[model samples]
Structure formats: C-alpha cells, structure tokens
Target: MKALRHVLRATTVREAIDRVPEAFYERFAFAFLLAWLAAPLLLWWVGPVIGTDITFLAWVNLQVGLGALILVALRLAAHLVPPRDVSWRVVLRDELPLVLLGMFLLLAVLATALSPTAEALDGDWYRRESIWTFAAYVGFFFLASRVVSGVLRRALLAGVIALALITCIVTLVAAISAGWHTDEGAVAHRAIAYFHQFNHYGYLLAVACVLAAAAALTVARRVLRGGLIAVFGILLLTLLLNDTLGAYLAVVAGLAGLVTWLAVLRRLHVTTLLLLAAVAVVVHVLADALGVGVAAEIASLGGDMVAVSEGSADAASAGTGRWGLWMITLEQIAVSPWSGHGIEGIASLLPGGYGRPHDEYLQYAVFFGIPALIAYVSAVVVVLVRVVRRGRAVDGITVCATAAAFAYLISALFGNTMYYTAPLLFLLLGIAWAGVRAAGSELLDAESTPLAEDRTAPTPII
Candidate 1:
C-alpha cells in the first residue's frame, strides 16, 4: 500500500518530469549542443569546399536543419507524453520576450505565404534563411531556455570560449604565413578564417571579446581570471587583424555597454577601471602596428562622406556600397508596408546582383514585413533591458550574454543577417533568458542592492 501510494504521488506532470534524473536532461542538452557546434568544423574539414555552390549549399542545409528537427521532435514528444498544467497568466507575464519571438515567427510565415517569388518562399541558393530556418531557430531558443542551466550552462559557455580562441589563433597563424594582402590590392586583407565571409569572422571575434572581457572582470579565481584576460587580449588582437570596421565598432559598443551596466549596478571598481584602460591602450598600440590604425579608417570614412556630399557619381561605390542599397531598400519597404516579399525576396529588386540589403533591420523588414521586424527587435530589447535591470551582479552568464547581444546588434547595422552568425546571437540571447529565469528570487533587481553592500555573495564562474 505504501509503494502504491508512492507511485501515485506523481500527480502533476511537473512531478513526473522531476522523477527523471537531472543528469539525463543535462546529457541530452550537451549532446545536442556539441553536435550543433561541431557541424561547421566538420564541414570545413571534409565537406564541400567553397565555390562548389550546389554541394556546399546541400551540406549546409542538412547540417543546419538536422539538429533542429531532432530537437523539435524531442520537445513534441515531451509535451505529448506528460502534459504539464501550464499557468498561461504566469507565462504571459514572465515570458513576454519569448511570446514576442513567437509572434515574429508567425508574421514571418504570413510573409512567406504571401511571397511574390518562389525564391523568397524557399530562400535563395546561397543564403537559405527560409521560413523553416526561422522556425527552427525559434524552437531551439525555447528549448535552450528549458534545458541549459547550472553546470551544463557553464560548460556550454566554456566550449564557446574555446571555439573562439581556436578560430582566432588559426586565423592569426594563417595571416602571418600567407601574406596579409588580397588579390584586389587592399592594404591588409580581411580575415575570413574558416568561414566564407570576412564579416562573419568579424562577428564571431566581436562577440567573443565581450564575453571574455566580462568573464575576466567578474571571475573570482585568480588563475582563471588571468587566463580570461589573456584570452581577451588574443581576441582583441585578432579582431584588429580582421579589420572589419563594423566589427571594430561593435566591440567598442559592446564594451561600453558592459561598463555602463556595471556602473549602473555600482559594481565598477578601481581595478576594473584600470584593467579596461590598459586594454584600450593595448588596442591602440596593436592597431597601429597592424597598419590598420583608427586614424586611417576614420580618414577613409570621412573621404566617403565628402564624396557623397559632393554628389560624386561614384560615391555610391565607396565604403561597402551600402548607401545606394539602403536607399533602394527603404523605397521598397514603403511599397510593401504590410505584406513583405519574403526571405531573399528583394534580390530581384536590388541592383548590381546583390542578394542582401547589407543591413539586418532593413533585411528583416524587407523579408518579413515591418511587423515582424518590430516583434524581433522588441524581443531583443526586452531581454536586454531585463538582464541589465534585474540580473544579479555576480551572474557572469547574464553579464556576458547581454554584452555579446549588444555587440551583435551594433554590428548588424552594417552587416546583413548571416546564416552562421544569426544562430549564435539567438543562442546567446537564449542563455541570457535562462540566466534571468534562474535568479531564484523576486528580489533580483541589481539596483536594489548594490554590489558594495553584497560583497560576499557567490559569483558563478561562467
């Protein structure tokens, strides 16, 4: 009778879920994440080489969609087998950003259904950011929020840091050995590394630098903190070598965001300030040595502005050729204010055979309409605001994740949504979401109790 009662004690679905070992969920999350992270490296090693368009796209399509499909299937099975009593009110109040993401996905589907071209519905051959991809992204995000926690979460972050370090080190070695100039005779060739696009490489470095900087600042272990500082130095140096202006600006913006948040929480100390100042000095010195100093880049930008102001015919050709493309995209957005053309829909409309708008906000509006864009931006803003306002000062995950997201947003202004980089940004955002949820207290506001008053609190080394 006692055994029967024990078995029957699992009345709620939440209780049934709790019956399973916690290790099971952690292992499942780790396996899924490992496979996803390894996909790119595996492709680079044995899969299709660049310029073999069809085979490369086929491989990428399979790699990107496979893990996501498995995750979706697992999530569905979990829901079907043990239905939990969900409080819709609580979800609505607490998970507003996630709800907004869902709305964005739905709006994207609507846009895809009403797409004018077949390419828009299925995505173009090169950049296959179809509706399916967006759906998978959203699913992965929601699942990440559930499974990624505690030790597994820290492991995932460490893996990401290691990946970034490996990539930057390899790129630096290549640049040193293989002449740093490209065929077009540019001063210093941009570092594309294993990825096809230099800007994509820039995106990775920019985010990694912010994460490393945050970890170095907050981690309590002396050796670990020193290692993180070294990692930050390498990342910053590689970022300078990558030499993408948008990425440079992104790193600056991200660091600024991190410092500002720390200051707001009253966590900024003299040591941290001195460390940051030293980092800045090192960056300037390295930039000068690399022959891609700040002054040179600024002069180039000024020259472009001057040409544009003087109405030069070739002004549109200067500085990434983005001015003309942005103008054209704005005009098209006005035409289709409600129903968008769908993913990669504006390719035909764009001049010079360009496939993307070179701007993420414009890309979102063009592909999925204005409402979708608003929903996506709103979700990001809400998550960012929540992390800055409510996350505890000792929570390194929240600090690093928020900083990385900020960097990505700033970089996205000049770079289009990339298939490789977009997933990373979403993952960081998801981790941030999870960190916010795991605060375990209603008194979670960082501003309510400053770090100075709570010096003995434990800090997670993530």
Candidate 2:
C-alpha cells in the first residue's frame, strides 16, 4: 500500500526527463547496437528448425523496437533541453550524413506508397526491407553517431572482433566435422556459419576481417595488436574456406583503401607496409597448403572476365548468371528511373528464378527510385569524407570503421544487403561519424589554447 501510494505521486514527464541524465539514453543506445550484433548468432542455434525468414523478421522487429526507444529518448531530450545547448548545436553541425540517410528513408516511404504491386508498408515475403526497417536503420544510425564515444567506442570495436573470432571458430569446427565435403562428391566450399546463406556470412567476414586488420596495424598496445592479428588470420582462413569471390575481392579492396588512407596521413611506416604484404603472402600460402580451392575460384573468375572481354555469347551464360541479370536490371531502371517499381520489384522481371539484382546500388534504384539511391550513396560518401577530414586526429577504431565501410561497399557491388549484416554496416558508419566529430572537437580545443599552455597537442591517436 505504501509503494502504491508513492507510485501514485511519481514525478511528471518533464520532471522525469530533467532527472535523467543524457548518458542514460546513450548507454541504452550502445546496448541496442550490441544486441543487434548478437541476435543473429543466438538465432543461429535454432535457424535450421525455424527457418531463415523467421530470423530475418526477428532482426527487423528488434531494430524497430530498440531504434524507436532511442528516437523517443531524443525527442524527450529535445523538448526539455534548450536548442542552443552546446551538445544540441554540435549534433546539428555534424549530422549531415544522417540527415541524408533520413531523406532516403522518407523517399523509400513515398516509393512504397506509390508501388503498384508491393503492399503499402510491407514488401515481399522473402526479404522485407520495407520503409519501417529503413526508418529503424536511420534511427539506429542517429543514436550511434550521438553516443559512440570513449568506453562505448572501445566496447563496440571489441564486440565486432569477438564476434568474428567466434564465427570463424565455429565455422572451422563445422567444416572439419563434415569432412569438408558433401555426400554429392563435391567440395563443401561455402562456410555459412551463423548466416542463412554463404554470401551473407561472407559479407560479415569481409567487414570484420578488414576492420580487425586495420585496427591491428594502428593500435599501440602490444597485446591488443597481437589479438587483433590473430583474429584477422582466423577470419581470413574462414573466408578462404568459402568460395565467395566477391568477399575475397572486398578484403583486398578494403586493405588497399586502408593502406592508401594511412599513407596519405603519413601514419603508415615503410616497415608496416612490408609487414602487411608479408601477412598477405603467408595467408595465401596457408590457404593453398590447406587445399582451400581459392585458386580454382580465382581461375574461374578470370576465365569469366576473359570470356566477357572477347564478346563471347557464352558470357551471357557465364558463372553466377549476373551479366544477363544486370542487363535486365538496367532495362527495368530505364523504364522507371524516377519512381521505382517498389521493394522486390525486380522479382517479376528476372529470369531463371533470380529474385534480386545481386547488386546493392542497382537494387536500391529498382526498389526505391534513383533519387533514393543517390541519397544513400551520397550518405556513404559523406561518411568517408568526414573521417578523411579528421586526418591524423582520428583514432584506431575510426580507421577500422573506414576500412569496414570500404569492404561492405565493395562487396555490395556483387551482393545485396542482408538484414543481419546491414545494421552492422550502419553501426560502423555511425562510429566513423562519431570519431570525426570527436577529432574535430580535439582540433578545435588545440587551436583555441596557447601553444605553451597546450600540454595535450593533437597527436595522431592510435
């Protein structure tokens, strides 16, 4: 009765908002990201029985739930706090990429509503990347950019590496137990791990491997650096176990981007460059010795390239059947460039039972219109530019985020986004933006302070 009486006299909404520190929502947002990362792994245990579609839907709902919470917290804070507050001003100044992403989401909603075949809010039954999911993605991005700092940043970085390590270990065990071959006498090439498809798992491995490698190169602490290297080696091994050529190319592109960016900043030593080359050679040799069949995949890819170059009609029938599908997708986009046919619009146009265009950029244009694609691509470009502008003031985690983004974008050229992996991509983007803001603030403080009085100069953070 006394507890009930006290509850009846609880503080009003405004008073409660005043009592709660902003850090609470930040912590909550951090937890939301962690949960999103771990959900697929947990669901993997029962994925065989329940089906991948269910797992995908579960992820979508989780994103919407947690993302909505963070958004609500922001609205409450905005209503109670003054607009001119330092933090509010900072957010407004550094939220351009997020703003562009929100624009894409709004345009997606319009496309969906105007869709002739797709349901108003819900997309197709297969991969339902509806307006609701895109809204959640934007909200998650906003919250991450706002709060990913200090300890939270470190935690998120560690989480990504740890998840990669765990996935590699489990995948190796499964492959070994299966004798690395199917009963059909063919090699069991693709290591699915926790994802429903080999390609989806490949996307995650690509990003994580790149991020881990970049972090290992720049991190100052010896133990952490060694651990990251080990994680990178394991991820590379697992990647080789699978025959996802797009993933292999993505890793190379990501590392190249990382090395090039660091060289531009004058942060990478000649010795570090040699070490990276040596590591690549070692991984290649190891994969060859283990009979990973990567060479055969590469040779096949090369043959396809040659076939296409010679103008062979067989190029239309080449491996992966992507050439013809791409042509069809281009034709469809030409028909409806401004307002797309809606989510999963390519399904009806595809031949040979293909669903998606297998290219993320084209898929976006097919589903949500050319404007939406431009907005999303611009957002990604803005993220890279923002981090680059931070220069040497950026930290090791930000460097990892940049490489991961490169890996994801490159891989997306040959693959579509998965519900499980897209959130991780957005999380890295948010972290990258957060790092840019923090680095800018550090530079600002250094400039404001006198040289003699500024004991803490803006040195390159590792």
Candidate 3:
C-alpha cells in the first residue's frame, strides 16, 4: 500500500527514529538537557496555552517514559558507528566507577527482588525517579563523552548560558505573577512559582545563580558580563526571598567550593574577593530591610552545626517533624541495614506522625542498601577528582561545575534533592570528565614535544 511505502521510506515516526544519525545522540542529549532545565515550567505553561491541566510530576513521569524510548533509539543509532574495542585492563584503569556502578545497580535490582512488597518497586515515587534518572545520566554521559568535538564542546557551554537565561526569564515572569512577595508563612510564593515544591525551587535558584555568576566572570565583554551579573543578582534575590535554609546553605557551599578551588590553584584575585564581599554586604543590607534574617541565621548555623555534631541532633534535622522521621528511618535501617528492605518499603513500617526521611543518603540506604550508597559516593568522588586534577585556571566552568556538584551534595543531606538536580548535575560532570581528559592529554602532548611560542594563536575555547 502507499501508506506502507511511505512508512518503509522512513517517513513515519518509527522509521525516522531508526534512521536517526549517530551524531544526533549528542545533539539530542544537549537539547534534552536544555528542556530538562525548564521542563516543569514548560509543562505548566502548556496548560494555560492549551486549556489542559497537567501536573508537574505527571509530566515528569511522561518524560521518564519518553526517556526510555530515547534510550532505545540511541542504541539503534549507535549501530551506525563501529564500536571501539576496549580491553578489561583499559576499562579497569579508566572506568572503575562505571564498573562499580553496574555492580551497584545489580545489587539494587536484587534487593528490590528480595523485597516482599513487589508493588513498591514501581509505586514508590522516589525509587522510580532515582532509577530512571540514573539510567539516563549514564547513557547521556557515555554518549556525550564519545563526541567531544570542539563544536559540540562549545555548544554545551553556550547551551548552559542559554538555559540559564531562559530560567531567569521564566523566573521573572513567575516572580511578577507572585506580585513580588515572599509570603513567608504561606506555601505559595515567587520562589515556589512553577516548581510548587519550595525547597527544590530554592536550590535550583542557587544553582542557576552560581552558574550565571561563574559564566559572567568568564566573558570578555563587559556589557554582556554585566547583564549576566544582574541576572545572577536576581537569582540571589529570589533565593533570599525563598528563605529556605537548606537552599541558602547549598548556594553558600557551592560558592565556597568555587572560591576554594580557585584559591588552591592560586587563580583567586583580591578584586574578586572584594566584589564578593560587597555583594554579601548588599544582600545583608537588603535582607535586613526586608526583615529576612538570612545572613544572621547563616551565622547562627555555625553554632547549630557544632551542637548537632556533638550528639545534639535537634538542630541536625531541619525540624522536629524531620527529626521524628529520621528516628523512624534509623529503626528501619537497624531492621535491615545491609540490603535495604526496598523502595517504599518504609511507608507502612513507619510510625504514626512520621514520614520518609528528608535526608538523601538515607533514601539511598533505605531503598538500595548500604553498598549502593557507597557506590554512589565513590562515583561522585571519582568524577570530582577527575575533573579537578591539575585543573585549568581560566575555565570558570570547572569551578562552577564543582561548586554546583558540592551544592547538590550538601543540599541532599537535608532533603532528597537528586531527582530535581540529577540531569543538570550529571551533564556538567560529563562535560567536566571530557574536558579534564582533554586537558590532561594536551598537557602530556606539550610535555612530550617542544612547544614553540606563537603569539598569533587563534582564540582557544574555554
């Protein structure tokens, strides 16, 4: 039939998917990375535009299903390029974390199988998000790493800037919609905006702010840099308005990481420090005027943290509710500490007035067990070391990326943040992995050969 002919000609969706170019994987990865940045907001916008009511997490679940389809298409498209032969020795030396990751996943699956409530495997919301996200992260990381051409690498950075800009625009619209108020006691506020979830929006704002700030520092032109700085300032303002202590701590941790990395490399400058100090002063003055004691509260956290570390856990848990939940999680851990009882396994086991622990480490342990938790930490440490080793001084991406990673890491201590930040976090780490490897290779090449000075060098890609 004519219809079958058109389908056979790769005109249909199925055929088109099969015919996707190998290079499209990296491009698609970047595109999806951009979409993921504003997906919730996009979904929310579509409701008004199309006269439909689609909730945020529902949209996310649909995205997860589509992600599975993408994985299949990527696999089929991969057949276009000949596979490289990698020896066990080479893999062990270069990708031990990846190997460990496979083992960890295997353990997790086995743990889930061992769980009595099989329905929890899919019914558990956090479990579903974590697994799908991890799979997508692994697939995208490997795909992106394969095609690190100068153009692709450049696109990634530009894409990040573009994504940040889009975030700022959407955030402004959301803020304006909120009538520019924090509504401190109320749940709905400017910072919550499309994200609805306050803490996720808060930390996301922190990440965006640092990302904008770092990118601003890297630009050569003053006008564009100033604009980015303004955007970063707006993001800070949103964070201040949100007043989520965890998000505040996360952003501060990230900024601290950025400063520490630069300082250790001797790339930190006094002017930069003074500018940062000035920003802090401005933020404090504004917060004081607004009656938001964020700066003072942050100072108080120093003592609070000390108190918690010294066996007083009231301050350690964000609140009494969280403290009660954490106690229940500890009981669950004691019941099955080695291999976890499984995802959503704690729901029924939990006591009255208690809920899931806000802590992410506990989430991993509760669902996938202790070994999987260890594997996750090991993987993070490996990537951080790889990206940061003998680092590049001029590229603010590494510093920003590292800071972002640390922020997510610290933020997760207070809540299950990985679901919200996973894609962006892993994307940066993937780029960092490729960049670090390239930088290391260039260094080796330079050491092996005599490099002649050339003043008329084409401008390098940061």
Candidate 4:
C-alpha cells in the first residue's frame, strides 16, 4: 500500500510539471534569443581550444537544437492552451523556401546513394547535420517573430546592437595597441579580436560599422548618439586597418544603401549627413595621429588589392576550374533533375572532391535539382516582393533591414553566405517582418481609438 501511494505521488508531480502555464513556457523564446546572441561569441572564444569539436558550425547546431527544443515545447503548450488564433500563414509564407530547400537536398542525397563517386566525396557528419541546423534556425526565427511581444522584440534588437558595439570596441583597441607603421615598414602585430580568420574579423567590423551608423541616426538621446559615434569611429578604424576588400566594399555598399533609403523616405536630415561626415573626419584624424605605421599599413592594403586583382585574373585565365565541377554537377543533376543530387549528395559527388561548390546557386542546383531551385527562388522572390511592396514607405527598421538584405544578396553572388549564414539572413528577414507587423498594429490602434472614443462619449436619447 505504501509503494502504491508513492507511485501516485510521483504521477501527481509529473502532472503538475506538464501543466505549467503558457506564460512560463514563453521564457523559452527569451532563452532561444539569448542562445542565438551568444553563439558567435562563444565560437570565437572556445573554438581554438576545442578545435573542430566546437567550431562555428557546431555552435550553430547547438543553438539550433536548443531553439528547436524550445519551439517544440511551446507548440505542445500552445496545443493545451491554444492561442486566440493559431495561424500558419507566417510559417508558410516565411519558411517555404527552407522547406523546399530541404526537400531538394533529400532528393539529391537519395539519387547519389547508388553512385560509386559518393564514397570519394567530402561527406562528413557535421556537414550532414548542418542541414537540420539551418532549418531549425530559420523556423525558430519565423516563429519567434510571430509570438514575441514588441518589448521583447526591441530587447532583441538592443542585444544585437550591443553585441556589435562590443565587437567594434575590441577591434579598435586591438588595432591601437598594435601600433602603426610607415610605407616601407610593417605594422605591429595585432590580436584577431575574437575571430579566427582575418576575413571574418573584417566582416564583423563591417557589420558593426553599419549598425553603429544606424544607431547614430535613429537613437534619440544625445549621450547615446555620441557613444554610438565613438563606436562607429572605432569600427571604421578597425575596417581600414584590416584592409579586407570584401569587408570594405560590403560596408560601403551597405552604408550607401542605408543613406539612400533614408533619403528616399525623407528621413535623412541635414544633421545626419553632417554627423556622418564628422565621424569620417574624426576617424581619419585618429588614424593619422596614431602614426604607428599608418602609411605602411596603407601600402600593405594597396599591395593586397593588387594581389587580389592578380589572383582574379589568374582564375579567369584558368577558366575558374569551377567549370569542370559545374559540368560534373550538371550531369548528376540530369540523372535526377527533379530532385538533383540529394540534400547532402552534391558535396559527395564533386569530381575532384571539393567540399563546397563555393557557389551557393550551384550548390542549390546541384543538390536539390531544377525543381527545388525554382521553388527556392520563388520563395525568396515572394518574400522580397512582399517586403518591398509593404515597405514602399520607409521607417528606421525598414531602412536598416533593406540595406542588410541588399548587402547579403550582393555578397551571396560570390560566397555561399546563405548556406552557412542563414541566421544572419533570417535576422534581417525577421526585422522586415516585424516592421510590417508594427505598421499594421499601429494602424489598427489608430482605427480603434476613434471608435472607442465615440462609444464612450455621452449621448442623449431624445
């Protein structure tokens, strides 16, 4: 009888745990946001120590797994205590591309299963796992945007800005401490500033620069503006010192797009342009003042540019060597043109066994086939069309998001930024979606206010 009573008590506890309120479950959204924010930083710090065990890809997987778990828990709770209206519209609208992409990949993998070449391909456990990671991150962002309150939404934006600012500051300090050099001499060695590759460091600085610039424009407080300007100066300095052409070009294009969008919306005040100019001048003066080898660093950057130009020429002369890979991939696509190679099969079928196609468009076509590529393209086109249609009138968020998307899209032409960097892309997408939602909410509020006022007003029944 005692044992029976204990079993009943255990069952009671389990029931209580399962009955946790939806409000309590909502904390998972915040948890997922925090995990997303911390992932890049953790990878930067611990990656070297742990080697491939904790790579950027691995960190992404962890965040995705946590996000998926939270999403599942939230869905389960929602079923128990349903929302007023559970619309799958946002999921279907925002996530169709990802779903299609996944299907394409699966088909490609299956088609390649019988091929002997698959054994010689660059298949790895991590690469295989990345597809799910990509899907989860995309799904989580879409769901979170739909469910999170405005206050939480702003908090997430603030977190992104704060991270950008911190990264900028670190890069600037590293550059200053390293000191400069003359045209003939080398600059002092500097720390990598939490990134493994120089290109990654440059990319981070470029992004931070844009975020800082946006903050300087939209943030109202004087003190905050000044702080943002200071941070922007530091990030600009870091970018110049790093001298990565891709980073430099991306920032220039992003900032130009932001400024143009703001101007088009009539949101660009004279003071904003003046402040931007002032920041640029201040950065230049600071670089000169350091005198720690500024000229030499400039020369180094020039040399690097020349070398890159030469390399491009060499690649062009060699017919990119990618053409051969492309042909092989096309042949594979012909075998299963509807699905392509399979989700993970393209990488497994490279003629010379290259890990990545290096071209994302090709990667998609090779892995998913023509049908999947068409669906993927259509999905992006739909989102682009929706966002553009709605965002014809500009606002702060729209301007920033539009610029971010433009930069990402342009960069995607050269690198497979979308495949590995889905979070970044989806973050921009979420911002655009949130902006649309906010606009609709404001319109509803405006419309309801007059109705409420009319209903409450004193009326005489004669």
Q: What is the per-residue lDDT of model 2 for residues 1-462, given as tens digits with 9 covering 90 to 100?
A: 553454456587555444454455566778777776666666676656666533564455556556755567655564545354346545545667877887898888888778755643664554556666667777667666755445576688678878878888988897877645422246444457656667777888899889888887777767866777777878887887775788999999999889889899738855545765676678878877777757787888889889988989889655578877777888998998987988786687797567888899998898889999999999989999877877776666678778897899899988876667777778888877766754365542221322311222212110
lDDT of all the models against the reference?
0.69, 0.72, 0.58, 0.53
lDDT winner: 2
Task: Compare candidates 2 and 3 on TM-score and give the better one.
Answer: 2
Model 1 accuracy (lDDT, Cα): 0.69
The residue pairs found clashing in candidate 1 are none
Error of 2 at 200 (Å): 1.2
TM-score of 2: 0.86
Better of 1 and 4 by lDDT: 1
Stretches > 4 Å off in candidate 4: 1-26, 42-60, 69-73, 76-129, 178-190, 281-359, 370-381, 392-402, 418-421, 437-462
lDDT of 4: 0.53
Q: Which parts of model 1 have CA positions greater than 4 angstroms off?
A: 1-27, 48-86, 182-191, 303-318, 391-394, 438-462
Q: lDDT for model 2, on a 0 to 1 scale?
A: 0.72
Cα lDDT, model 2, residue 353: 65
Cα lDDT, model 1, residue 406: 87
For model 1, what is the alpha-carbon lDDT of residue 335?
86
Q: Sort every candidate by TM-score, greatest first.
A: 2, 1, 3, 4
- Per-candidate TM equals 0.83, 0.86, 0.77, 0.67
Candidate 2, residue 264: the lDDT equals 91
CA-only RMSD, every prediction? 5.9, 5.4, 6.7, 8.9
Best-performing candidate as measured by TM-score: 2
Task: Point out the worst 10-residue segment of candidate 3 by lDDT.
Answer: 452-461
Error of 4 at 455 (Å): 20
